[model samples]
Structures are given as structure tokens and as C-alpha cells.
Target: MSVSNEPTLKPERPFFSSGPTAKFPGWSLDKLKTESLGRSHRSKIGKARLKYAIDLSRELLGVPDDYLVGILPASDTGALECAMWTMLGPQPATVAAWESFGNVWIQDAVKQLKLKNLTALDADYGEIPDLASIPQDNDVVFTWNGTTSGARIPNTDWLESGRSGVTINDATSAIFAQEMDWPKLDATTYSWQKVMGSEAQHGMLILSPKAIERIESYDPDWPLPKLFRLKKGGKINQGIFEGATINTPSLLATEDYIAALEWAKSIGGRQAMFERANENARILEAWIEATPWISNMVSDPAKRTNTGVCMVFGGDWYESLSDEDKAGVPKKIVSMLEERGVGYDFNGYRDAPPSLRIWCGGTVDAEDVKRLLPWIEWAFEEVKASHAN
Candidate 1:
């Protein structure tokens, strides 16, 4: 069946970028303006707000009680770096990297930290390494979901329950939206901007009791920047975990995050959020299954990510294009959708292969995602018609 160039239905809200994603369904500037602005973050009110964010984040994500959950400077990168610099040097490390963000961690471990006893397990995009192959005695670092590649570990069965080494996970796009195996994760980091759909620049770092012990016991030989320091005088800084952030934070962003957390609570918390994300992905999956012109980037259905649904064009139209033209097709399709005000930033990551990555996080409504699918088909047909001789 030929798709129409004119799609009657449009997404009710077209803000679908994977990062700095669509805010909570009823978000407004008023929700953010309630922040205690024009006051020091060190003040009682400011600290209380920060602490609220921390406490709410812990509650929403179901973090363990003994874990040290804190708001860190910068985004998810800062939180990962804070963990890496503080805890990685003492043990032989193994870094598993499949897509863009995970590769960055591997690079930092090998080139920047110049660790000698590091093993980097690399996989192609849309594929995952064998989690079972990682040594139990080695510190393991990996991304919980490869946002760009749209591949995620299906479960935590591969993780050793009584493992000796710590497992640090970069879960920026997976937290809240996905069920995490908290017991298997020693350190996990995420930005407020991804799953929660809050403003950027603030990261939530969740550390298990084991991770805290590593921080208090070991210090990196290389001098850590103030941003990466998690300890003071050979002890883990207890104050940072209690809302005393190492650097000044955006009060406005904090308020935005709190509003999001409240919205999350009103919607029944993590399980509800996870169901929303999965439902959104299911909408797109049904469309992909029926549509001959498109297919998911992930080869394994079980490994596919529910949040960032990356898809590539198929059939003769895509096959006829040269390598350079094929690389640009996804962009052309994105431009057509954007020109119609149907979608924004629907294009895949710059480093990933040509495809469209639709954000299917908790904040996105499944009906909106369903509405967007017909537009995608419409845009693809239009782009394909133009490219044909």
C-alpha cells in the first residue's frame, strides 16, 4: 500500500529529542518558577530543595536505602567521571562499549587515565558484548542501554550475584523508564534530562555500599579535578550526599526536576513510567512490523531498547542509493517531518549509522508515538519519491 504524502494526524506534542526530551505531560514554566531563586544554594531553603530532588530521585528510582544518592555537577558525564576517577585505579578494569557514550568511557580509561591493566570489550553498533565473559575479579564499566545503537542488555542474569568486583553502569537513558537490577550495580549515573524529561546539567549519582567503600578506601594516583573529587581527607564526603553539592547548581533546573518527580509520583512511580515507555515502543514496533520500508536497527528483538527506538529504511528504495546518499536519507526523512512540525530531532546520533531515533521515554505519550508513525511513513515516501530518477 502506498503511503500518502499528506498525513492528517500529527503528534500532539512533537518534542521527541532523546536528550533534553519531552517534559512531563502537564509541564509549565510555572512549575519551574516556584524554585527558591535569588538565594544561595547553601541556604536552608536551597539545600532543602536539592535534598528533595535527591530524596525523590531515590524514591522514584527505588534505590536501596544504604546507597549514597547525590546530585552531582554537570550531566551524566560528570557523575560517571566522579565514579571512575575515585574508584577505578585500585582494580584491573574491563570496559564494555557498544555505542557512542560507552566508547567515551573506554577512551577515558585507556588514553586519559592510561590504566595499564584495562581490557576494553568493543562491539559493533546494535550489538552487545558477552556480559558473561567479563571477569568477576575485574572492575566492569558499561552502559545499561546504548542510546545511539538502540541496544540494551535484556536482563541481569549474566551478572554474578556474589562477584568480587564492582559494576559501574551509565544508565542515563534507562533509569526510571526501565527496570534496573540495583543489586548487580555498584555504581550508576544518570542525567535528569533523559528519562525524567527535566532540564539538563544536573546528574544523579547512585552509589551502592560497595562503591562507597571503594571511594573511602582508595584514591586515584592522578590528581582529581574538584569536579571529580568524591572524598575529603581519606573519607567519603558525607555532606555531598546530603544536598551540599560540590559546585553551585541551577535552582531552576532543580525545581523543574522536582515537578517532574511529583508528576512521576502522581502517575504511580517507576512501574507506571516503565509501562508508559514500553507501550510507546510497542506502538512503533507494531508499525515497523507492518511497514516494509522500515526496520529496527537492533538485530535481536530481546536486545532492542524501549526508550530510544532507532530504525532504518529498507527495501529497493534504500538499496538503490549510493553509500553517501544512503547516509543522508535518514536526515532527509527527518527534515521532511520537521518541515511539517510533526517531529524534531528525530534523526539518529551523528556517530551512529543513518536512521531515525524516536524518544519513547516515560514522558512521551503512546498515542503521540502512534500518531508520529504515520507521519514517518508519509515523510519516507516523500523523500523516496524525490530521490528516484
Candidate 2:
């Protein structure tokens, strides 16, 4: 019997989803086939590769020498939970929530941990709550970039330099894509799927000297989960900060992380990556200005994110359309682009206001973004055409 011939499925152009964003420019399936399979993470070879990856992260991000870098289980959520459960109880806490992820942390602190004396300062998606209102006496938690909202904190200037409280930063979408003032931060967490474009399930946890000191000197009275425990008797277990991950990790994932780091370095490191993201943002900014119905979700240009540039339909763009038309607009636009093979996941987050989120990260080429702009126009035209029918 003869089998019928058929073509396998493939994406023509890349998807520009906010995260689990884009892979390295030249990535291919063959790279994975050559990776070591069934290798123990504890093996000397595996440890070396892991160590090298951590070291490269430090060098590329310009993390201080005294800081500790470790690969954590899960993604940014795991890293943030570990810090909150382990290190937050020693002092009063203030959490600033401007977007979905920031609100998640606030929920963890208030509901999950049930910490009293916690102040939750929140703002709408496009704006930050007053930074001046944050208490200097309490440990502060905030995102450097609000990926879902497209708003970002301009810098660490709002933070008090000599404050006794530690600043924990959830920089999942900000790292490598924007400038981070590490000196003002105590503990910072990021995921592999963001700027680096590696697979998810891995997080990078960086602890400053002050953060390490807090872990070593301050004992939170809360019961610590094994996964969240980072210290004993006010001292960070050095092993956990080194190769001692709380749970077993995928060696294959670790190798991919290493490769991503190497790719980041070869592309002129952090500055180059920043430039790439910023350039992408500029391209979108130009288009947004020209488009009548579209506008950025972020109110302040100073705080607009280069990585995740979210846009909302202007005025009554939604209200003006019929209910069916409105409901189908975002879906149709995303589907049309995906079908055309020009862009993939550009849909705004469900929790966010109806909008489109384009990921303009380092791994995404500017030329691809330029190509994507025309497709976005075409997508809206298709949507309009459908509405007219």
C-alpha cells in the first residue's frame, strides 16, 4: 500500500506573544536533537554548564559580584514566592500593584501568607500608584515593567537609598530588555521565557548583599515550605544559591538556558538587547501615532515599556462596532495574522482591557517588527472588511 503525501504544519512568520515570547533568531529543531538526553543534573558536566550559564547571566546583566545567582524551579512566580515566603516577615511590607502579575504578588502577601501590617497600593493598569506613598520602613515589592499593562517604572529614583527595608523586584519582563538599577534592589526575579526566549519552567533569582544579609540575619516567624526555605538561623544556605536547587531540574532545559545566555552575549550583551527592544518600541510608537483607532495603554511615555508594548482601541472603537463585531475584532485580527503567517500571538491578556500586546524583546529582530507593522494594517483592514459584511 502506498501512503498519501502531505505537508507538515509550520508557522510562516513568528508569533509575537508577550511571553514565552520569541525564540533566538536562528533557533532550529535540530539544536534540541543534539542536546544531551537523560543526563543527571548532578553530573560534573551538567554542573559546569549550569555554573557557566549563571556566570554568563551575572556578566551580561552586570549583576554585582557579591550577589548570588541561582536557577529556581518554576518561572518568575516560583522565584517571587520563594522570596516572599522566606524573607518578608522580618519587617512590615508594602506591595505596589499596577498590573496583573504585581497584583498576584499582593494577593500572595495578603491572602496566602495572611500578613497583617501590609499596605497594598494599587493603580489602574496604565498607571502606577503614587511611589511617594510607599513606606520606607517596610520591605517594598513592585515590578520594574508591567508587561500586561505596558507601563514601567522609569528607574529606582523613587526608592530610598538608605532605607532599612529591602526592595524586592519582580523584573520578569524587564531584565535584559531595559535598564535595571540593581544597587537599589535587594532581591530580583526573572524568567527564562522573557527576554532570553528560552523555554519556560526556569527562573533566575538574584540576591544582593543586602538581600543575603536579610536572609542571614532576619528570621521570619512564618512556617517555611521546603521549596521556599532559603535560610536557617538568619543565614542563607550557600548550597541553595549554588547548584543546590530545591527540586530536580531538567538538564535539557538547563542546557537550553545556557545556549540562550550564550546567544545573548554573542549579540552584544545587555546594551545591544536593550537597543533591540527599544528600537522595536520606537517602530510601534510610530505606527501607533499614525493609526486613528489605536493608542498605547501606557499613559506616561517615561514609563512605557520597550518589551511589551500594549495598545488599546481609542475612544469608542469598541463601542462603535456592533456587539458581534466587537467580540470578533481581537480574535479575527489575531487569527488573520496567524493565518497569513506574519505574526502569531498578539492578543491582549484576558484580564487586561481589550487591546493588543506585541512583544518587542531582544530576540525579536527589528526587521521582523517592520514586516509585522504592515501585517497589522492588513489585519485591521480584514477586520473592517468583515464588519462591513
Candidate 3:
């Protein structure tokens, strides 16, 4: 059947960027707790707010009582770096990467920190590496979900229960949307901007007791940047995990995050977010299965991510294009969809092969995602028609 160039209905809320994603259903400026703003983060009220964010994050994510959650700088990248630069030296390490952000960690291990006893296993955009092949005896670093590639580890069973090494995960896009085996993750990092749909550029670091021990016991030979330092006088600095940050923080962003967390609580916390994300992705997955010209970037449904759902062109129209033309097809589709006001910022990562990545995180409504699918088909048909002439 020929798809209409114009979709009858557009997404009610056309805000689906993977990061800094769609806000909670009832979000507004007044929802933020503004009392903490315009005050020094070191003040009693400010520290209390920060501590509250930490505590609430723990409550919602179901982090263990022993685990320490801290607000860090530079979004997820900063949080992961603080964990890496502090704990990675003097241990045989394994880094598994399949997407854009994970590759950055591989570069840090090889070129920056220059770990001699490191094993780096990586795959193409939509594929995952052999998780079973990774030696659990060594320090393991990987992303829980590949936001750009839309591939995620199906479960944490592969991580050894009794392991000598620590497990560090960059779970930026997966934390609230997926089930996290917290006990298995010695060090995990995430940002509020992804699933929670809060403002961007802030990160949360969750550290297990084992991770703290690693910090206290081992010290890197090279001098750590001030922002990366998590220790003081050969002891793990407890204050950092408390409200006392190494640098000043944006209290406004913290307020925004707090509002999002409160909204999360009102809506039944982590499980609610997980269910919404699952339903949103399921809606898109159904559309992909029924549509002739569109297909998921990640083939295996179990391994595919429920948050950032990446898709690529398929069928005769896409297959017939030249290599250069095929590279631009997804971009054209995204641009046309945006022009029609049906979707925005749904383009795939620059480094990944041409595709579209829709944010199907909890903050996005299932109905909006369903509405966006027809618009995607309309955009594709419009692009194909233009190219033919």
C-alpha cells in the first residue's frame, strides 16, 4: 500500500531527542523547587537539597543502602571519568564497546591512561561484542545500553557473582528504563537528562562499597585532574559523596532534577518508568515489524534497547540507492519529519551508520510515539518521491 505524503496526525508532543529528552508528562516551570536556587551550594539548605537528590535517586533507582550516590559534573562523561581515573590502574582490565560513547572509554584506556594489560572488545554500530568472552577476573568497563546503536545487554547474568574485579557501567540511557542488578555494578554512572527528562549537563555516580575500597586502596601513578580526584590523604573522600562537591554545582539544575524525581515518586518510581519505556519501545517495534521500508538497527529484540530505539532504512527503495545516497537517506527522512513538525532531533549519532534514533524513554508518552510512526512513513515516502524526480 502506498503511504500518504502527509500523515493525518502528528505527535502531540514532538520532543524526542535521545538526551535532554521529553519531560515528564506534567512538567512545567512552577513544578521546580526554586527555594534552593540563588544560594551557595555549600549552605545548609543547599547541601540538604543535594543530599535529598542523592537520597531520592537511591530510593527511585533502588540502590543498596551501602552504595553511595553523588552528583557530579559534566553529565555522564564526568561521572564515568571520576570512577575510571580513580579505580582503573593496577588491575587487569576489560573494556567492551559497541557504540559511540563506549568507544570513548576504550580511547581513554589505550591512549590516555595507556593501560598495558587492557583487553578491548568492540563491534560495529548495531552489534554487541562477546560478553561471555570477557574475563570477569579483570576490571570490567562497558555501557549497559548503547544509546546510539540501540543495543543493550539483555541481562546481567553474564557478570560473575563472585568476581575478583570490579564492574563499572555507563548506564546513562538505561538506568531508569531497564532493570539494573545493582549488586553486580560496583561503579555505575548516569545522567538525569536521559530517562528522567530533566535538564542536561549533570551526572550521578553510584558507587558500591567495593568501589570505595578500590578508591581508598589504589592510586593512579599519574596526577589526576582536580575534577577527577576522589581521594584525600590516601583515604576515599566521603565528603564528595555527601553534599560537598569538589566544584560548585548548578543548584537550578539540581532543583529541576529534584522535581523530576518527585514526579517519578508520584508516578510509582522506577517500575513505572520501566513499564512506560517498555510500552513505548514496543509500540515502535510493532510499527517497524509491520512497515515494509523501515527496520530496527539492532536485529535481536532481546538485545535491542528500550530507550533510544535506533532504526535504519530497508526494503527495495533503500537497497537500490547508491552507497553515497544511502548514507544520506536517513538524514533526509529525519529532516523532512522535522519540517512537518511531527518529530525533532531523531537523527542517529554522527559516528554511527545512517539511521534514525527515537527516544522511547519513560518520559515520552506511548500515544505520541505511536503517532510519530505514521509521520515517519510519510516522511520516507516524500523523500523517496523527491529523489525519484
**Reference-based lDDT, each prediction:** 0.90, 0.82, 0.90
Tens digit of per-residue lDDT, candidate 1, span 1-389: 34465878888899889998999998889767564898899999999999999999889888899999999998999999888888898889999999999999999999999988999998998899998888898999999999899999999887889788999999999998888899989999999999999999999889999999988888678999998888888888888999999999999889999999999999999999999999999988888999998889998999999999899878987888898989888898788788889999989999998899999999999888988887877777777777763
- Model 3 vs. true fold: TM: 0.97
Please give the lDDT score for candidate 2. 0.82
Model 2 lDDT at residue 302: 92
RMSD of each: 1.6, 5.2, 1.6
Off by over 4 Å in 3: 1-5
Per-candidate TM-scores read 0.98, 0.93, 0.97
Local accuracy of candidate 2 as per-residue lDDT tens digits, 1-389: 11222223333446688889898888765565334467666776666666777888899999988999988888999998888877787789999989999999999999888887899989998998998888788999898899899999987778988788899999999999987787888899999888888888988899998888888776667777777778755568776666767787777777777777878889899999999999989998999989887889987899899999998875454668865666567778788668757678889888888788999999888877877776666667666656556
lDDT of 3: 0.90
Q: Show the colliding residue pairs in model 2.
A: 15-344, 216-234, 216-235
Displacement of residue 15 (Cα, Å) in model 3 is 0.8
Q: State the RMSD for candidate 1.
A: 1.6
